[model samples]
Target: MTADRGVSTVVGYVLNLGIALLLVTGLLITTSGFVADQRHRAVEEGLGVVASHLAGDLATIDRLASTSDAEHVAVRADVPEQVAGRAYTIHVSPDGNTTKIQLVETRTGVTVTRSVHTSLTVSESTRGGGSLRFVYDDDGSIEVADD
Candidate 1:
């Protein structure tokens, strides 16, 4: 009878250890997921700030394009101080009817685009994965398409 009790006690201890290990693993996974989510949110906020600054710059470019007669003009853009690590490109068509700006955040892999329609006084901005497309309509509104 005593032998049977000892074997049962050993089995119970082993089962308890297994359960504890599983619980610990689950907690680790949950914590990892939470950390990942926080990081993603931070990246998104940073990208949003970059996008907003680009939009403001594009608006300035649009105003210049409307008033100036200079063809094929290139202006060095000033980005937000917080996003100094990212690279930005601003393109102004020769006609000055359309302007497109692209911001790429290397560390977070986030890309944002903003475009302005000078004739219509409309601006469109979008953020996400993949390539960005900017289309101008005759009515003066800008269209942003993301692929």
Candidate 2:
């Protein structure tokens, strides 16, 4: 009877250890995947927020230029050095008679472009820094410069 009792106690402890190991492994797997998913989601969401903000700003500038009597309108924006822990670039192009804002993630090879309708032609340039400046001329032209 004593021997059986000892054997049962040892078996119970072994079973508990195995369960604990499985639980820990499960937790680790879940957390790793959650971290990965959250990382990409955060980047995509941030890019989207930035895109919308820029689009609105550009559109507002266009409206102001057309409707208001202001000579020039200047706007500043906060630029991020990395998107999802990867370097990115912002491009403003004027070839199509519309200003296109592009955010490209170098590591992931992801590019997001937002096109804003504008009557004025823009000077094409690559912009980078802590902040950006958008100057709208009296004639409705746009000049993009970084600071």
* Predictions in order: lDDT: 0.55, 0.75
Instruction: List TM-score per model, in order.
Output: 0.49, 0.68
Model 1: lowest-lDDT 10 consecutive positions: 86-95
Q: Between which residue pairs do clashes occur in model 2?
A: none
Best by TM-score: 2
What digit string (tens of lDDT, one per residue) describes model 1 on residues 67-145?
6654433334444434433443333332355555555656656566555455534354534433444434344444444
**Clash number for candidate 1:** 1
Tens digits of per-residue lDDT for model 2, 80-147: 76666666677878757578888766654666788988866677878652477778876658777775
- The local distance difference test score of model 2 is 0.75
Could you tell me the TM-score of candidate 2?
A: 0.68
Q: Report the lDDT of model 2 for residue 56.
A: 75
